[model samples]
Target: MTSLAPSGHLTIGEHQLEYRMIGPSPAEGPTLVLLHEGLGCVGLWGDFPDRLAAATGADVFVYSRAGYGGSSPVQLPRPVDYMHREALDVLPRVLDAIGFRRGLLIGHSDGASIAAIYAGGVPDHRVRGVSLIAPHFIVEDTSVQSIAEIKTAYETTELRTKLAKWHKDVDNAFYGWNDAWLDPAFRAWDISDHLAYIRVPMQIVQGADDQYGTLKQIEIAEAECYCPVEALVIPGAGHSPHREAAEATLRAVAEFADRILNGHGEAAHGQAA
Candidate 1:
């Protein structure tokens, strides 16, 4: 149940990323890597990381990507392929730098997409399972509309001021994600092809009332992925289930991680009939 402060930094390429570690040491049980959402960072995760650690007894490694929190800033107008680049390029290095052993990826929104891409693209044996919260597998009108609404809020409301507290370069953090999603070409952005390649068990958690995405995201996983896929739709929760419905999300994630990492079930592979 030990929670360590996020006083560590790792150099990935030219960027300095800020991260926090909780629970047992790396030599202990499997690690849970917490990947933040589009506008999220290490600080934005609040007490969820600590609670997850205490509940599962697994080391939780949470980090702020470039241009967010205390991490290095990035150029504006990020490419629409940013998530793909992060999953294929940056995540592998981060895992290596952290000496990642056996692990499970717990990701939210943009972070969840990255985890899905990585699990499908890389042949890393260290990744045992994936828990995706509010993940988007395809571009939907609802997601775009929500992103547009947030953009307006950022410009006119206190959202920008609130986010500034978490991001060192708030504009870069916001615009990078906002602009990419709102771009006309991004409407065709889809990661459903990646799901077919994922070899590990996966748990997809989404809020029943998630404004940013629809249940179609989970349906794609069930239809495409060769691995076992479980879906949870929490009522009264929105896009950020881990934040909106913390207790329920924590219980589901903790149980799934325990089962996958502790060898409590049969292997999860092969296409569904």
Candidate 2:
């Protein structure tokens, strides 16, 4: 495995992606790779990575995709198939770049979808399980409506200014995700087909009141996946259960990682303080 700095930039193709490695390295133990939600970057995740690492005992890897955080900029009006491209093209390179040996993918929203696409589409044996929080297997009317509303907030409120702190190219980060979802053709965007291909056990977490998606996403995973599937629904939370319900979310993710990685129900790794 490559020697990783605590935090630094990784050159993957044309982009220099910003990343953080918390706790143990891949060579030391199992790894948990975090895929952030749309409009999210390394900074937005705050201390969640360190907390997750402590809870799971496995190393936690977090990175900002192109155009997010301090990473390189990407073309505007991102392709509707952008998630697919990231799953099939960029994420593989990232895993290889980090010398990932064996690990699980823990993704939120867009990142969740990307992980599903990668695990389902790619036959990489290194990925042992997938945990999705507020994932979308298919585009929902709620998703489109929420995205449109956020765009309005970005223009009319301080949302852009707040996000600007994390993204070097805020508009690129915002519209790349915003414009693609709003595109009429994107309504047909669905990756539930990917569910049928996943071979590993799966864990899914969602808020009871996630504005971006609904329980239907969970139903879709249960209906299509042949692998073992488990889910957690955090009440009074929104799209980001990890933020809105941090402690519960951390415990769930930690337990799932421990059980799947160690072949037991108990957490084999020591919790970080």
Best by lDDT: 2
Model 2 agreement with the true structure over 1-273: per-residue lDDT tens digits: 466899899999999999999865776668899999998998898888899888877899999999899999998879999999999999999999988999999999999999999999999999999999899999999999999999999999999999998899999999999999999999999999999999998888899899999989999999999988887888888999899899888888888888888876753221122
TM-score, every prediction: 0.94, 0.96
Alpha carbon deviation, residue 78, candidate 1 (Å): 0.5
lDDT of 1 by residue, 17-115 (tens): 999988545545679999999999999999999998888778899999998899999887899899999999999998888778888999999999999
Q: Deviation in angstroms for 12 in model 2?
A: 0.6
Best of the candidates, TM-score: 2
Write down the TM-score for model 2: 0.96
> Which ranges in model 1 have alpha carbons more than 4 Å from their true place?
1-6, 264-273
lDDT of 1: 0.89
Runs in model 2 with CA error above 4 Å?
266-273
Model 2, 202: alpha-carbon shift in Å? Answer: 0.7
